[model samples]
Target chain A: MIKARVTVTLKNGVLDPQGKAIENSLGSLGFKGVGSVRQGKVFDVSLDVKDEATAKHDIESMCEKLLANTVIEDYQVEIV
Target chain B: MIKARVTVTLKNGVLDPQGKAIENSLGSLGFKGVGSVRQGKVFDVSLDVKDEATAKHDIESMCEKLLANTVIEDYQVEIV
Candidate 1:
């Protein structure tokens, strides 16, 4: 089996409202030193395929098609 | 400045509906080899402080208090 990991994050120009909320929450919680925060998503995927190359390619396509919004977000896939 | 990256994931034995949804989605998309998928959250935190030790300690406490729900989730804090 191959383990594929994917991380989905917002684009540079995109406004992250969730991140902004976290920043405010941290400040309110007395963590004044925390500056801006950008939050993202992580996926731990286990594939039944044994070939690493096939898993990597499939997962990359998965990220492009559904795991991430290509227009506003970027995704990185790693097969282990 | 210190960059603290936090990854929050559900503890073992917890039911992950989102993960299950992803798994089903992949299967529906014709990716039949996809077994199980676990989804988690990532926080890219920027600290205004310069000292690494202080930032690490503060971020650890921050994770415990707000960044993650220690009761059902596990969090890993990294100071860079």
Candidate 2:
């Protein structure tokens, strides 16, 4: 089996209200020096495939097709 | 400035409905050889602090106080 991780994050120009909320909350909690908190999603996937190259390719396709919304988000896939 | 990435994932034995949904969807999309899929959260945080040690300590506190639920999830912090 091939193990992989996919991280999906909002595009730079996209607005992230959730991240903003976290930033504000952190300030209220007295954690000083915090700035620009961007939240994203991570997926840990175990594939039945055995090779690294094929695992990477399949995971990328998964990101494009279902894992990420290409219009507003960007995704990175890594085989571990 | 110090930049860090925090990854929070559900601990073993926790049920992840969203992950199950994604796994099923991937199967429907005809991406074969897929196994268990676990979903998690990632935070890309930039701190105004200059040192890595202090940054790591503060980020850990943030994770404990807000970023993660200690009862059901585990978190890893990395300085980048």
List fnat per candidate, in order. Answer: 0.88, 0.92
Model 1, CA-based lDDT: 0.89
Residue-wise C-alpha lDDT for candidate 2, range B1-80, written one tens digit per residue:
78999999999999999999999999999999999899999999999987999999999999999999999999999998
Residue A9 in candidate 2 has what lDDT?
A: 94
lDDT of 2 by residue, A1-80 (tens): 88999999999989999999999999999989998899999999999987899899999989999999999999999888
Candidate 2 deviant stretches above 4 angstroms: none
Steric clash pairs (candidate 2): none
* Residue A7 displacement in candidate 1 (angstroms): 0.8
Write down the lDDT that model 2 would get: 0.95
Off by over 4 Å in 1: none
Q: Which candidate is the best by TM-score?
A: 2
**TM-score of the B chain in each candidate versus the native B chain:** 0.93, 0.97
Error (Å) of candidate 1 at residue A32 is 2.3
